[model samples]
Target: MSQTRSDLRTIQPSARIALLSDIHGTSSDLDLSRLRARRLQQAIEAINGECPDAVLVAGDLTENGDREDLAGIRTRLDLLNAPWYAVPGNHDVGPKAGIADDQPTSIGTAAYEEVMGPSCYTATVGPVRITGLNTSLLGSGLPEESAQWRTVERDAEPLPGPFRILLLHYPLFADHEREEAGSYWSLDPEPRQRLMAAILRADHHLIVSGHLHRPFVREWRGRALIGAPAIAFGLPPNDRSVGWMRLTVGGDGRVTAEERPLAVADEVR
Candidate 1:
């Protein structure tokens, strides 16, 4: 018989996932790129030391989604002892049209897929069911948008897992679920509501995201929403700690997250 939500809670804890984001890796040999590479290496080593069951990269794996850069980032990530999954951030897939920026045009979905597999995917890791989404396409009116929506809808159906984790590049909202959209840092309003509704249907217990370059944890509708720290660098006006998140789901379906900061000594100028 398929397990019910209540049954899942009683299952023994069985998963440890390392969450990292905003790697900002690049193929360039510039100083900033070199620093980011070093930080990424340190972060990977830290994660390995934790001996996680799996790794989830929230997005921005590359500085600009350059094929070479993405390839290089992938090579580094492969060093992790655990299998890893990732979604795409704005930097990896390009922002929606009309956004102002000095960055190059979108790398286009095909190129990104060539390196990162798929922009959206669902995987089972131990007792958790993880669904990764591409927030950049949330409201971009692109052909892939419809397909992704179907995936979201599919995810809403109950699945047999002690925990369900929704992973994405952008947080559904910064402060409150009712917050306004059009902010460069978050998903637009319309898609946000739809996505939340679907998550509610599935009763997802946790939502993990990275993009703000800051780390925070908030509870909404009894679900934990976590903003993971950036692995490449820090942004001001926030935690700004360059590191990663260690998330553990216990047997009782309780989720705990710890921030693992990269040693200051490892950060070289």
Candidate 2:
């Protein structure tokens, strides 16, 4: 459905952005270091060459919130000609699976803020207003989840902009427009409904996220759901497209996004 060209420079862009996700920069198992680092480095170099206005990372900057891993990824991101921003993914600060339903999360929220700034925030890139959400708190029962939702409700209000883009790690639905809340691919029932309602209430044009590690796009009502593929690895036949999404927002609020494959020689870990 996309009329794509070979490079970003070929298009006349008022403001260009590179959206990257799921780099999974480090592994506790030392054996996988070279593989992960090589792919991430390639993606970073590719983004720098594009000379976009900004680079937005959808999350999973590291494997399991490793301080060293976050440091490595942040160092490489510093090389980009443009500023880079991000939100947290499940991998970066998600609570462990066995935590009780009523308990708070001992996840890496502090580390994330200390290492990557706020887990959620808003920024305007030219004509586009980007609102980032930390979906890692979906079912965690953490008090931060409630506070975040309140903040998001406030932040998602319509602003004077051409595009109101929302960035989160998880998709509202893993499969289709009508899917139920508790699908294995997205947030649980309560948070799912709450988040969906919030987005629909807001004046939003698009939603971009990364977590499934696969590239897919869908449209519901008037908004577009754009997903980015993983850079560190792929999910076999489903996620063969290892790349980032490039977007161009014009002065009139018109926006277009295209997927650009990475320049790495290897496609799998």
Candidate 3:
């Protein structure tokens, strides 16, 4: 029997995971309603057409803790047709941040969990252990949330696998300065440095994040750390449109992704 083009392609293991991050209420931004649908359909088609097993929303699933924002994210993501998981971003919380919310602040965990299910948790797929870290604890004015990284790092016990991938909203290591981390709502050097050390010490294969909103791919020694472009809106210092990533996690555990802008008419060839 001659195999169809799709059939000839290897379905990424039931262990494969589709990652999404930093959506931040872009669900209704401009023509994003249609673009979002198409981007998601492309991803689903990649998963179903190539047939991956699961999808994971890394973080920043909403712009704010607005019910409408969160609900919209959940609805679009539900179309993936597989067991899905998510972590929370700074915007997922109502506002108070590091503290629990009572009046629905904007950057707290409780608000995110209300819609996304849980702010921080773990899901295992095949021999892989995907740990979703909540870096949003370190919000716009809060560095104390950096402590949460300790909890996740400490609780990240040894996993009996060839790869351990940590997914989060903020990049622990970024192309930013120590004094600049606070301004950008990113992890300070100490927290980020420690987190990177912990991940490396634990022998993780990859660490992925999206809060930076810029797209970058770099490898330390041989390990890869990816910064994904936000699907909601592109980052500052540039005029690019919104984009999403297609990550191919290899069997030998090398990770690669291409950030494709959504509103552009020129497609990936």
Candidate 4:
């Protein structure tokens, strides 16, 4: 038994995965949407140039969760030739702590599903398995306002694969692990702990997340954790340029992630 392919297509056992997160629905964090869109376009072209089998977005597709952000995001994503996957961040879902005037995150789960496919789903690329989970909960103890959890859980079972990957909006560990503020709001810490247990139990290669709008990577418990920066906004105090991550998964199933900035001069949307 050669044991080659997986569920979706022929399992080649290795594939390149370009990871993008926290776009925030704008062309750029700078002014003038023209150059910003151009930089974003350039980044996508570069990713495709690497011959990756697929692209992944961890979350925060729009700024302020506005409907218009979809337009810019769609434009950038359309330029990609390979298949891609994405989920909503806290911003795209409206107010994270509910509305200022008592509004909810909206039960438009179906709408998100239709617009960007399933809110929480799984995709098989050759021998690698990529699964996206929705971590933006409405209430403190809630899972999501929808059944997206069931979908992710159903498809999240570990497969005997070359690489197992999980795409989530929130960091898996507790926010207290890093900073005091809720910078990692996308990760409902409680549910994430459970999800982390599941992934560790299954022995995955890595878990990727965004929403902090800062690119970071670390390894723990034999799991590689990767996070991408905001493609639209820069962090407070305006230190360095914002960027995305390019992941190269080798034939031996090892992955190397690089975070590159979309630094085009005077660009913003």
- Using lDDT as the measure, the top candidate is 1
Alpha-carbon RMSD, each predicted model: 4.4, 4.6, 7.3, 5.8
lDDT by residue for model 1 over 1-269, one digit each (tens)?
11112223454665788999999887665877888988899999999998999899999998778898988898999999998999988888887444665553334566889987888888887777889988888877778888788888887886655588899998999777776756877887899999999998887888999998988877677777888889877777444478998887768766678888887433433
Q: Which is the leading candidate under TM-score?
A: 1
Cα lDDT tens digits for candidate 2, 139-252: 667777776787679875655434677888887777765665445567666776777778877766678888888877676555667778887766655445677878776554
Please give the CA lDDT of all the candidate structures.
0.81, 0.72, 0.60, 0.64
Clashes of each: 1, 0, 12, 6
* Residue pairs that clash (backbone atoms under 3 angstroms), model 2: none
Candidate 1 structure, TM-score to reference: 0.90
TM-score, model 4 to reference = 0.80
Considering summed lDDT, which 10 consecutive residues are worst modelled in model 2? Answer: 3-12
Which lDDT tens digits does candidate 3 get at residues 179-251? 4444354566665676766776666666777777777777764556777676655657354555655566665
TM-score between candidate 2 and the true structure: 0.85
> lDDT per residue, candidate 4, 177-205, as tens digits?
43333443544444556566677655567
lDDT of 1 at 235: 76
The per-residue C-alpha lDDT of model 2 at residue 39 equals 73
| Superposition error at 58 for model 3 (Å) | 2.8
